[model samples]
Target: MSVQFVGLKEINGPLVVLDNVSNVGYEEMVELVLEDGSVRTGRVVLLEDKKAVIQVFEGTRGLSLTNTKTRMLGHPMEIPLSTEILGRILSGSGKPIDGLGEIFAERSADINGKPINPVSRTYPRNYIRTGISSIDALMTLIRGQKLPIFSGSGMNHNKLAVQIVRQAKVTKDGGQPSDEKFCVVFAAMGVKNDVADYFKSSFEESGVLKNVVMFLNLSNDPIIERILTPRCALTVAEYLAFEHDMHVLVILTDMTSYAEALREFSSSKGEIPGRKGYPGYLYSDLASIYERAGIINGHKGSVTQIPILTMPNDDITHPVPDLTGYITEGQIVLDRSLDLMGTYPPVSVLPSLSRLMKDGIGEGYTRADHSALANQLFASYAKVQDARSLASVIGEEELSPIDKNYLEFGTYFERFFINQSFEEERTIDQTLDLGWKLLALLPREELDRLDSKLLDEHYHPEDARMFRGA
Candidate 1:
């Protein structure tokens, strides 16, 4: 039997304190019935002996200390789960909000998910093609790996996220389309109405809405709800991946918003602040989210995560990105300078990398030449930067002939390779071929990353001269 008690302890910002509460566990759900018969929901946040501090999902505004009744529901907050959750739009708290009714749940899952044991984990291999040349050819997203995109405040990370959602796919060996089930779970926290609408319309227009599960938390929504957005999305993802044996790609955008919400919630709790006024557990809290992505040894499916967070003021050293970098496998950094140059994705090549790409690509995976092509591209792009730096000091005309070739290669590389239309989707082969074409612009001696055999197979300066003349 449940116990209902009259509440008269205290009311904080979004939290209410109850005294003499027995048998109430931390994170246990609570119901607050107001004097007028309206009810609000909350969960236990802090427990001190007989006192329980509950955080109200709906802010406590009209509750009377004397007349309000509180009831403990025994279990922690859980969301209904089913395969039907795909293609549905849910609120931050995992409630259906698309004019559709509640989910006819297969089962209810705790929002705080179970941690996957490291002993049961399988090493991640293979790749999920994003269809972006720069990412596909350079920082290939390995299935079950956690790679984050670090963006600035006003950069095109949102656009990049949508593009990935639209174009991402799981491929078989040799770049053939796989028959395995793959889906995307996208959660947007603290985004404005316009941005949320844009995500919905973009997905719908691309005809990929049926494969996507979206959890949107608006800017006006309570900070408590913002904290639940990614958790809810990940819960759905885990259900699909682990239970149904499907590959799931989870994208949590603007995690900076989620961290800020945590900071505010921490302040309300009057907890001691750590670096930059954030709670001391910020790193652990982020690890709990990033570490959830991987493949289990017994499961056929995998969960790959691409968490996108904006670096405050483009400062990578900010506490949010700094801690995130320490947890995630690798980062795709967005360049403000490249964005200003009208580059679409604006991925900063030198700073961005996927740590698992080397293991995922080449041989039976993408192509035999992928590894060498990528290395040569990186080496040549580095030279382009040096050439530009020297040209800025001396005149461009004063640079050596080899340096002039690098400058031309750099311009063509950015214009053709990195800069593509929003609708453009390139295959892994197309991306690799484009890289070789750019490499052809340089003299044979400049391409030292490739061996004599690869040079004989792919290097052709005559082709480069013909293409440049065209």
Candidate 2:
């Protein structure tokens, strides 16, 4: 038998407090029948003996305390899933908004997913190529790895993200597409309408829309719905990867907005705030999302995550990003200074890292020379920074000849190496070859990071001279 409660105890901001409720569990779904007979959805956020507080997905505005009735659904919030989800657009709360009609779901799953057992997990080793040289060659993205991109407001992380979606592919040794079913699951929480349209058009233009499933929660939507956006997307992803045997890439954007919604809700609930006025469970909350990504033992499919969050004033230590750094495998940080200088992607090479890069590259994966080439690039770029700082003090005209060469190298590093046309997709081989071509510009003695054998085969001063002249 189902129980209904009338005359709610209280109506807080986006929350309704019901008294004398029995057999209610945390996160269980709720229904509100207003006096006007319109229905609204909610979930149990906090529960006490015979008293349950529900956070309404649609804000509570017209509900009269005396007339409204609340019903507790026996199950938690769930999303319907099927292969029919691809090429479809859904609301933040998992409703179809694309006018395509409801999905004929094969089954439904709890939005609050189960944590994967650590003992049954397999380490991520497969490399996913994004066709961006800066990422593919330097900060490699491994399948089943949780790598967050740290960006500041006004940076071009959106452009970079779109390019990544368009170019991401599963490849075996020598860059051939692996025989795996690949799909993308994208969730946007609290983003502007224009931003959401841009993503839709970009994916459609690239012809990858058929392989994508998008959940959009705009800034104008109710604050409470933002909380369910990512969880809903991940739930579908888990179904595709674990049940359907499809490799999935899940992208959650503007996580800062999500965190803000969490803070607002926590404050309303009278929960004590932790760092920066965020809930103390922020770390556990993030882990629940990030830990869902990985390769499960005996499963052919995997889930890789690229969560994009804008740091408040570029502060990496903000509670949102700070907590994320602790749970994720590594981070891809975007440089505001580089963006100011007209660099596309504007990736901060030194600060960005991929912890699983070592396991994914080299030998039969990308290339045997991938390890050495990456090391040499990092070393040389570090030198370029040093040389630039020195020149700033002594003036480029007064610098030694070796320092001047480094100044020129830095220009090429940014222009030809890091910067690429948004429409152009480069292969791993092409990126590595371009690295050698740039390295050849430097004198042989300066390339100390390269082994003697690599230098003998790849170093061609004559070719470098001709290319530089041309």
Candidate 3:
């Protein structure tokens, strides 16, 4: 572990230009020896005209350019992969953060590693129920898939995460091999003290902490460490799935904080700006974090990622979520209007979708009638929303009976479908049954989305009885 000095040349904004370096890779981190006798680590962000632009990990506060040296490490930051990390803690730099002893691994991995081969990709199918209806019923989260959630400040994304951990299940009763029921790899980036506390408390209270390996990068932690948070998390997840043969659900909350840290390091390095003053390599940077999720071919274990990021100014089109949407599967959109209405999940049902849901729901995975019931409820609710909009303008008394029924269905949708708290849990069959109850209000002819057999068999007077009592 001796110091390897590559020698520094000049200070440009936040960047320290390195003159002599070998095998310098993009985003490759290096160690910098300051003239004041302090050492720091930085990443090589740009290579132009044979000079490398390095973004100092520790902000340049009191470093002299005269004698500072930059030495390329010849490798990127990495974490050891092993089950010894369970019940242990780690830092954002892919090293042990908690006071627990260093985690032992059979091998180490490159942090800025290569992507899993496309030919080796295992297709995503099967649902991971997060207990919240907005996510489970509306926008289903599929196993071995990468699904990003979009939320705004003051929204209940934290609560949503807790609910997911408390309720997410890996198997479909007798269908899954007992050894493969889902475990969780939950990580937080730049989260505040109270928020971090709640995540731990919720997991412990729900009795899922034993199976979860948490990696926390608190707001008080070093800013440079934020970039390492997710990598450290995925390393363990990789170990759990590929080695221990477990299904690991990785949840990283508040990704904007991580991006901001990237921006900070980028600014310190004097790199060219991309959108909103972020680094020009924002997209590729995000891909590195998101691409870690999936099932590898011929591997018994799988790593499914549910990355939650808050949008700046509530703009979904913002770079963080926009780039994420492009890379990951469909999103679970939390609705502000639903939140104001006191809906616990606040998920906007219409816009939220799961491209991988088709692989998971219906027939053997869930109930036999899951797909038809889900679609029927969605269509019925759409009509209900339209009718309610018209009624608000023309008065409820002026609306037709069918429109009035649609209004009633809207109320039932919110009260019955979307208003569940974090602690409550429901089976997939129960969820589909509830959807059928809502569909019962509409005439049998309007049940176009459902198959005739399921409707004839399960759709009945008793189906609407519960919602009817409401």
Query: What is the lDDT, from 0 to 100, of the residue 204 in candidate 2?
Result: 93
Highest lDDT model number: 1
My TM-score estimates for the predictions, one after another, are 0.98, 0.98, 0.91
Q: Residue-wise lDDT of candidate 1 within 56-126, one digit each (tens)?
A: 98998998899999989999889999999989999999988898898899999998899998999999999
lDDT of each: 0.93, 0.91, 0.79
Q: What residue runs in model 2 are displaced by over 4 Å at the alpha carbon?
A: none
Clashing residue pairs for model 3: 6-70, 6-71, 14-268, 14-269, 15-268, 15-269, 90-97, 91-97
Compared to the true structure, candidate 3 yields what TM-score?
0.91
Residue 31 lDDT, candidate 2, scale 0-100: 93
Best-first order by lDDT: 1, 2, 3
Report the lDDT of model 3 for residue 274.
Answer: 90
User: Model 2, 1-470: lDDT tens per residue?
Assistant: 77888878899999989988888999999999999899999999998888899998888899888999888789999999999999999999999999999999999999988989999999998799999999999999999999999999989988998898898999887666788899999999998999999999999998999999999999999988898999999999999999999999999998899999999999999999999999999999888888889999999889999999999999998999999999998899999988999988799999889999999998788988888999998988899999999989988999889888888888888888888889889999899989998888789999988889998988877656644675
Q: Which regions of candidate 1 fall more than 4 Å away from where they truly are?
A: none
